[model samples]
Target: MDMTIDAIDARVVPPVALAYTKALTLPHLASAVRPRFLVLQPNGSLNQANSSDFQHGLESILEQATDGVIVDLLWVGSLDAYGIAALVAGIQRATALGKQMLFQALDAKSRLALEIEWAQQQESSVGAWKHTFSSNLEAFLDNFTHG
Candidate 1:
């Protein structure tokens, strides 16, 4: 099936809320075809400070999603030790259900740091997770749309 991903920039509360609203409004966004996957880009906003709230939002979306519809998440933010633990916990939960969850850092330095931390805390298999570091949104969109 052809994949359609709605790339949402959840940088603020309103946009985060709007992302969820837009997912629910999928029927109106396109004609005939419903989205095969929902890829969430919780950039900068998803952090240890707001882990609980972020998890709640994700859970809500998961609960509402149709069966077989994949929820692919990329969480990016400045994470403290505790926040990183929380993020890992969330990733584990998603993995248990066979969901596609990625923990990405927006910067190269942060990405390297996260990779080391993830390797140390490797609760799951090495291939079970993935990471990405890029600031270019348009390039991502073009590749995503074409591929």
Candidate 2:
């Protein structure tokens, strides 16, 4: 059965044409063991259809990371529960290893989704939970990596 949907949970965010875009990663800090900035500059909606790809890509890249991933949701025009779950899963992995994670450029709806899901999980907000709304990216990464 083929059906059409009118909108996403993020009604304010205009819908974007789904594209086969992958998250782009770069080494933000050289000396740090953890705090690797895994930027998710995806060019498509992080929805149910692509959650697995997002999660796997994130985890695969994260496996090489030490501290946390810097999820840049600047290009993510749409987000759903599954996407949030994937993000949380990565955060859970980082937390299990006793490290903090950070994300930026997230919309309020998506951010709220994460917060609501986080409240339900009841996990320690140690590694991935500590968030600084605004700061110089370089300085933040430096401060994030050190104790």
User: How far does residue 61 in candidate 2 sit from its true spot (Å)?
Assistant: 1.6
TM-score of each: 0.42, 0.58
lDDT of 1 by residue, 69-106 (tens): 23333344355554455555555556566655554334
lDDT string, candidate 2, 28-98, tens digits: 33443333333345555877998877777767556655544566677677888998998888788777766
Model 2 error, position 75 (Å) = 0.4
Clash statistics: count for each candidate: 0, 7
Give RMSD to native, each candidate. 14.9, 14.8
In candidate 2 the C-alpha lDDT for residue 101 amounts to 58
Q: Residue 67 error for model 1, in Å?
A: 9.0
